[model samples]
Target: MLKLGVNIDHVATLRQARYRGREQGEPDPVRAARICEEAGAHGITCHLREDRRHIVDRDVFALRRTVRTRLNLEMANTPEIVAIALQVKPDIVCIVPERREEVTTEGGLDVVAQEPALTETRRRMNDAGIEVSLFIAPDPPQIEAAARVGAQFVELHTGRFAEAFGDPAQREEELNRLVEGARLAHRLGLRVNAGHGLNYENVRWLHRVPHLVELNIGHSIISRAVFTGLARAVRDMLDAMAGYTGGMPGAA
Candidate 1:
């Protein structure tokens, strides 16, 4: 079955927006993550950015202690985060490209350019018994680089594919790239996990992708919670994903 790793970074984002370092009357991301897990999230993902913006250090530690399901910690290849990850030792560590200026992760890590950094990072995480994943664009070179760096998984950046949702021509092109990228990665013995800009409307389309082990979605699911509530929103997405397993009829 295709697993759903719900990203809870944005829940902390909303909390931080109100608290703004004051730390009062804020919804705890750990609690929200537990809710998502109870509602059927296979795992929880939180990115601890360089700037203590959304998911702070405390949130990561709390989630580590509380989340029963797999914990996928997204971080950059930096000394500070590396040390923290070694100490916390989450189930998985997904290395991604980060920029303080960007509102969110704009795209995947450029593994080709940062090959040495990725290689060393993967070694450190693997030594700590942590599964290492590279959040990379659906490019052959990047996928190849991930394999060379001994990454356990490759999370395809689906932002561009999501953006081209309504355009048949553009969507087809982007989807083809992802499909091929997944195939290539699988052949290289790397587990495939994808996410970025995936929402209810476009998520089912990902069913066409083969060998995809997981999808780490956040902003869309959190936004939907504003109306449907967290548990219900997570369940709805799980139902959608369940429909696609075993190629069940009428999944879309």
Candidate 2:
């Protein structure tokens, strides 16, 4: 079955907005993670950005101690963050591109350009027994580069697909890109996980893209929690992810 890795970064975003520079805050992300796992999420995801935008060191460490399910730590391939990952040792580390200016992650990491550095980081992560995943756009070169770097997984950046949801032609094109990306990644011996802008309505279309192991989602679930509450929001996403039967029949 397809799994849901509930991203709790946005819950920390809300807390930081009101309580930045404070010692304590309401709506703790660690607590939020426990609720998500209890609601049947397979894992918890949080990005510890360099700028300390949302999920912070405190939150990451707290999650490492508290999360019952797996912890997927989203991070940039930087020296400082790499060292921390070695120390904290989350279940998996998804290497992504980071820019302080963008409101959110604008796109995937260019693994082709940064192959040498990324390969080293992946090596370090694996040495520490933490599996490495690269967040890349659904393109052949990036997918191939990820395999070359020895990444265990590649999370296809779904922003473009989500953005094109309103336009039928564009949406189909984007979906095809993801389909081909997943197929290539699987054949290349990499596990597949996708995220970024995935939500209740648009996620139903993802069944077309085969071999998805998990979807890391945050903003949509947190927004929905305003009315339905966190546990219910998580359960609702799992419901939407139901009935996926894996798109490629005999391919693993």
Candidate 3:
């Protein structure tokens, strides 16, 4: 079964719009995590971004205490966040690239470029007995670099493929790249996961991807929650993804 790591950063984003710094109110991310778990979400993912634009320190601590399912902390490979991760010790730490300006994570981290630093970071987290995963592009070089850096898993960045959605030729090409990337990563013995811009519709086609164990989705699910409520939103997504485990029905 494909695990759904529900991202609640946007829930905090909605809260931050009016709650001021650290104030509690309506769209509480902590409560959201609890709701998600009760609804059968495999995990709760939240990025404690550098800018504090969305998820913040308090939220991470709350989640660490409240999240019954796995608490995956999406962070950047920076000293502050790294220290926080070590002290808090979430179940999984996914290192993603960040820019203060971008509305969301624009793309994956360049593991090859940051190998030395990333390796050290991974070592620290591993020493703490915390599993580490790198959010990276679906490229062989990046995957190999991640493995070399001692990452237990590599989360394939699906932004390019998601952006290509609805365009037959481009979508096929990008999907092929993801398929090949997953094959190479799996061959290297790294567990595989993917996310970014995935939703109810685009996720179905991912039944073709091999060796994928988890998908971290946010914006789409959160947006859908506005209409259907949180529990149904998660169950609905799991229902949508249930058909994917056996591999694509007829894809070559």
Candidate 4:
């Protein structure tokens, strides 16, 4: 089944905006995870950035304890974060590129250049019985590097496709890239999951890319929750994801 992993990082972002140094805060990420799971989210995802701009160590530990479903931890491949991930023991970890200045993840992790470090991290996580995924752009080289690092999954970055959605020609080109990327990753024995810039409207177009196990979405759902409530927001995305036949239509 196509699963939805609700990212509650922004919930913590909201809390930290008002209660950064305080011990207590509103809009707890753990509570958000609970609500998302209750509303039929297949998993909860949170990024513990090195800067601690949003989701903090305490919140990750709490989610590790409280999240009933799966907990997919998104982290940079830094030693500090790797150590914390080992202690937290999240179900899966998607190693991603990080920058202090960028407001968010601006691009995919360069698995090709960082293959040695990523391979070591993947081994450690596998040793701890944690599945490892590489958050990479839908490119053949990166996907191959992910397989080389022995990652169990590759989360194809859909930011480009989402950015191109307004133009039919560009959207089709990006969609074809994603379709081909998914096919290559699957053939290399890697499970596929995609995210970034997926929203209620654009997500439905992803059926053309085959072998998608889940989509980890955040900003759009949380923004929608501001008006429609979190549960409704989640259900609406699920509704959008429904009826995916997983056929690679028009894929070369």
Candidate 5:
């Protein structure tokens, strides 16, 4: 099965929004994770941003102690977060780009441009025995740079592919690039995972990408939960991946 790493950031976002004026059950991300586990999520992903925007330090520690499945920590390459990661030591850590102004993760980390800094961060995280994944684009240079930095995994950002869903030609082109990138990464001995902007409509679009072991989905699944419930929403997406019949876009 294609593993599903459910991102509970939006769950925290909702609670934070409500906490602006009212309070309820504290709206813990760990609790939301348990709900995801019970709903059949293969793993849990949380980003501990510099701003404490959504998931916080406490949430990361709590998940490390609580979750039965793997925990993938999303963070930027900063001394503070890197130090915290050394102490918490989740199953996996994905390094990403961070900006105080952006509403959310707007794009993939420019690993090619920041190779030296990224290389050092990757070394520290790997030495601590935590799997390091680079959240990069489907560009060949970025993919190559990730491997050179000694990262064991690379998560291709699917924001472009998802946005292109409206235009068949654009969507097909983006999917093809991702498919090729995944194949190339796997050949270089790196685990390939994809996420961001992926929804029910484009869930199975990357099945043709070789060696794709996991997909981390957030906003779309959580939003759909408001209508279909979390478990059903997750299960429905899993079912789509398992039932994919067209041999993916570039399965040649």
Candidate 6:
């Protein structure tokens, strides 16, 4: 069965909008995580960006103590963040690309291009007993590089597939990339996961990607939580992803 990793990064995003100077709050990411866990989410995800933008150090630290399920920390490979990750020791570490100018992660990490830097960073995280994953576009070179760098998993970026939303031809083309990428990575023995732009609508079709073990979704679920409540929103997603293993990752 595929697992659902609910990302609570945007909960902190809302909180940060008000408390730019310090930690003051109404919407708490930790609390949001608790609700997601109670609702049967297999894991909790948070991306502690370099700019201190969205999820902060305080939140990750608190989540370390509070999250009952697995804590998958998405981060960039930098000395400061890697240091914090080692100290925090989250269950899983997914290295993603980051740019200060972009509103959100614009694309996946070019693991093929940055293999040297990622090689060392992956070593540090793995040495700390944390399973490492690389967030890369579903391209062969990047996926191949991830294994060479010693990452245990690779999160296939689905942004392009998602952007093709209503266009059938574009969606099918992007889906082919993901299917082929996941198949190749799986053959290499890399545990595969996918994220970025996965939600109620598009997520159902993701079951089509072979060998996807987990889906780390954030914005869409959080946005739906505004109307349906977090628990129900999670359940709805769970319901949407019912039978994802038979040539499709999720059920109707």
- List TM-score per model, in order: 0.96, 0.98, 0.97, 0.98, 0.93, 0.97
The local lDDT score (0 to 100) that residue 197 gets in candidate 3 is 94
Candidate 5 has an lDDT of 0.86
Per-residue C-alpha lDDT of model 3 across residues 138-165, encoded as one tens digit per residue: 9889999998998999999999999999
Cα RMSD of all models vs. native, in order, equals: 1.7, 1.9, 1.4, 1.7, 2.4, 1.4
Candidate 1 lDDT, tens digit per residue, 25-107? 36889899999999999999999999989999888888999999999999999999999999999999999899999999998
- For residue 234, model 2's alpha carbon misses the true position, in angstroms, by 0.4
Least well predicted 10-residue stretch by lDDT in candidate 2:
243-252
Off by over 4 Å in 4: 248-252
The per-residue C-alpha lDDT of model 5 at residue 3 equals 89
Q: Tens-digit lDDT track for model 2 on 1-252?
A: 999999999899999999988879978999999999999999999999999988889898889999888999999988899988898999999999999999889899999999999999999899989999999999999999999999999999999999999999999999999999999999999999999999999998998899899999999999999999999999999999888867755332
Tens digit of per-residue lDDT, candidate 4, span 1-252: 689999999999999999998888989888899999999999999999999999999999999999999999999999899999999999999999999999888789999999999999999999999999999999999999999999999999999999999999999999999999999999999999999999999998998889999999999999999999999999999999987767456522
Which residue runs does candidate 6 get wrong by more than 4 Å?
Answer: 246-252
Number of clashing residue pairs in every model?
A: 0, 0, 0, 0, 0, 6
Q: 173 in model 6: Cα distance from truth in Å? A: 0.6
* Cα misplacement distance, residue 28 of candidate 6 (Å): 0.4
Q: In model 3, which regions exceed 4 Å deviation?
A: 246-252
RMSD score of candidate 2 (Å): 1.9
Local distance difference test, per candidate?
Answer: 0.91, 0.94, 0.91, 0.94, 0.86, 0.91
